[model samples]
Structure formats: C-alpha cells, structure tokens
Target: MPAQPIHTNRLILIPFTLKITKTLMAGDIGILQKLGLQLTPYWPDQEAIDTFPKIIHNLEKVTEPTGFESYMVVHRNSMSVIGDAGFKGLPNDDGEVDIGYAIITQAQKNGYGLEVAKGLASWAFKQPSVKAITARCLLDNKPSARVLEKLGMQQVSTDVELIRWKMMNPAHEQDTIDC
Candidate 1:
C-alpha cells in the first residue's frame, strides 16, 4: 500500500509523489488545486524549488511513496502549503533515518517546526525498521537547533559547519532491555 498522509494537530504532511514533484517543478499551480491546498505567497520559495529536483529524483526510485521521502507540509486550518518536511530516505543499515524540514518565512516561529519534527519522529519510531532518527543543522542555525532540541534529540556530534543530532527509539531501547 502507498503511504498515507500524516496528520498532526495543526498540519497534514502529505508524502510527495513523483506526480506532485513533477507538477510543482513544471510551474503548474493546478497541483495545489487538486490537492485542495491553498498557496502561500512565501512558499515555493527558492529553497523549496531547489529541493524539488532532489525529491523528484528520490521519488523516481520507487513505484510509490515509502513514507521515508519528503512530504508537503500543509497547514490544517488554512490548508496552505506552509513548507516541506520528511526523512531523507529509508533507514540506513544501522536502522537510522535522517530528517529535515523547512518552513516558509511566513510560517516560522509559530511552533510548526517542532510540531513537524515531533510528528515525523513519532511516526518513524513506530516503524520496526527505524531504531533511531537523526538530524543536522548548520552550527549557526540556532532556530533549527532549538527545534531539534525541543524534540528531545541529543547533539551526537558537531563539525565546523554542522551539528548532528540523534534520537533513539524508546521502544527499541525497551526491546533491547527485554531481550
């Protein structure tokens, strides 16, 4: 079965399909209409546009969304496309998946970032294959760091340019103890 949309209290994360990515990259606004979503003036910004090619390329690898790729972040009340968020891909051999998100300038500082990250982590932990979720933010990106921290992710390491964070699945830890 194809991946289903993940609904949070105030947002619905719709997994990106090849068709949606292609339509967006084609500069077609009809996809929004079809999805029953509103357009935010600040969305489809340069950063979001640039990420489409990558989303498209990744989506092309599978016949359907695996719920491990990118998702369109839509506001529940306004139904507006506020941004994008999701796992980079399936869990690696270590059973860890990396998550990333971007909220439009208009939607920033409203607690949406934490909401999205929390929702993603919650969903990921429920998957048997996902033992941990990892994330990274630029060393200077305090806002992003705050979001990850708020989600209870620990700073696993840091480099000159980025700080890596990780959150292990609590259930997985429990299983280890029970084993």
Candidate 2:
C-alpha cells in the first residue's frame, strides 16, 4: 500500500489503487476524486494511453513483490494529469528496482519529469527493503537522461540501445560506508 500522497515542489504523486486503476481503464476519470484522490480528472499521456491496457492486464494476473505500482503525477496548481511515473517491479534481492515515466508532450520540458522521479524515488527509499532505484532510457532520450541525472542517479551502465542509471538510498549508502 502507498502513503497518503507523495508530494513534490510542483506535483502530487497519487498511487493508483486497484479501484482507481480499474476505474481509469473503464474510461471514467470522475470516480477518482471520490476515491480520495485530490486532483482533477486524469488525462493519460500518449504512453500511458497506449500501455495502460497491458498494465491493467499484468496487475490482474501477477503479484508484485512490493513498491511497484503506477502513480499519477498531478500538477499542483492545475490539479491535472501532467504525466505518469512508476517502478517496473519491487526491489530485487539486491534491493534494486527499475523505474519508468513519461509526460504528455505538451507538459514536457517544464521540470515535471524530474519532480516525479524525485518524488517516486523518495517514496521508494522510505521502504526499508528498497536500497536503490534504477532507470533506463534510450540513448536518444536526452530529456529523460537529464531527469535521471538531475535526480542524482549516476550512469551505472550502458549498452548500444540504452543507458542505465541508479541512485542508492542516501541513508542506506551512509550505513554501508560507515561499516
């Protein structure tokens, strides 16, 4: 389960509960407000629009370890869906989890991406089992690379097709270094 709501400088990260995700998949955004989500109706990004069906399908068929769930990024002032961000799955045995996010084209470049990443990573770090958050982006996705970099995630590995970034929980890192 997620906390009340993960807040950032310009956005609110609302975890998508089963009811909310199901409602969203059913094409009714109005139900969200009544579900305790304090925001305007949702408007999924092109990516969210395209991938939500699969997301719903997977959520129904599988059980995630923990800390992996979709979150809606609502613009604080406008109370609107600026984009979405989430972990690919719960942290692994090594305490690493992959993350993914995207903003609607219109909302791009306004620092929302970094804000969402920061908010999500902060939330994940609150889970004692989560040690680090990781993300991968296509080499051409400079904006995403910038978001990860701005969130203090280092470029840990790269391949011809993508660059991988990771940021360990600061407290956990300090504990390790102090050992």
Candidate 3:
C-alpha cells in the first residue's frame, strides 16, 4: 500500500513521490495545483530545491513511499506547503533512522517545527523496524536544537560544527518486556 499522509494538529505531511519531486525540480508550479496544495512564497527555497534530487533518487529505490523519505510539510489551515521534513532513509542496521525538517521562514515560530518532528517520530516508532530516530543540527542553531529537545531527543554527541541527537522508541522497551 502507498504511504498515507500524516496529519498533525496544524500540518499534513505528504510523502514526496517521484512525480512530485521531478515536477518541483523542473520549476513547475502546476504540481501544486494538481496535488490540491498551495505554495508559500518562501517555499521551494534554495535548500528545499537542492534536496529534490536526493529525494527523487531515494523515491526511485522504492515502488512507493514507505513513509521513510521526504514529505511536503503543508499547513492544515492554508493547505500551503510551508516546508519539508522526513527520515533520511530506512532504518540502519541498528534500527535507527535519521530525521530532518525545515519550515519556511514565514511559518517559523508557530510551533510547526516541533509538531512536524513529533509527528514524524510518532509515525516512525509505529514501524516494527524502527527502534530509534536520530537528528542533527548545527551547534549555533539553537532553534533547531530546541525542536529536537522538545521531541524528547537527547544530545548524544557534538562535533565542532554539529550536535547529534537521538530518541529511542518507548514502545521498543515494551516489546522487550519479559512479562
């Protein structure tokens, strides 16, 4: 089955398909209309545009999205894609997956970042293969650090340039219970 859209209180995370990523990379706004989505003036910003090729390459590896790739972050109220967020890919050998999110400048500070991160983590934990989710932010990016902290992730380590964080799935513990 195709991955279903993940709905949070204020946003809908639609998994990016090959077609959507290609169209967006081609600089076509028609894809927005076709998907019944609106675009914020700040969306498709340079970072998002640059990520399309990677998203496309990942999408090509699977016949359908497994909800482990990029998703369009749409505001529930405006139906406008404010940004993008999702897992970098499937879980690693250790059953850990890395996540990342970006909300357009105009949509920042509305708690959307936390909402989307929580939603993604929640969805990921439901997958039997996912035991933990990880993320990273620059040492100077306090806002991003705050979002990760809000999602219950702990700062596992840090390099000169980046802070790495991780959150283990609570359900994984329950599954290992000896009762």
Q: Work out the TM-score per prediction.
A: 0.95, 0.82, 0.95
Among all candidates shown, the one with the greatest TM-score: 1
lDDT of 2 by residue, 18-109 (tens): 66677777777777567554453336545776767655654564453234767777788877777877876657898988888888877888
In candidate 1 the C-alpha lDDT for residue 94 amounts to 83
Tens-place lDDT per residue, model 3, 53-161, is 8899889988999899999999988899999999888899989999999998988999999999999999999998998899999999999999999899999999999
TM-score winner, 2 or 3 = 3
Report lDDT (Cα) of residue 155, candidate 2.
97
Residue 173 C-alpha lDDT in model 2: 97
Range of the 10 consecutive residues with the lowest summed lDDT in candidate 1: 170-179
**lDDT of all predictions:** 0.91, 0.76, 0.92
Q: What ranges in model 3 sit over 4 Å off?
A: 174-179
With a 3 Å backbone cut-off (N, CA, C), the pairs that clash in candidate 3 are none
Model 3 residue 57 CA deviation (Å) reads 1.8
Clashing pairs in 1: none
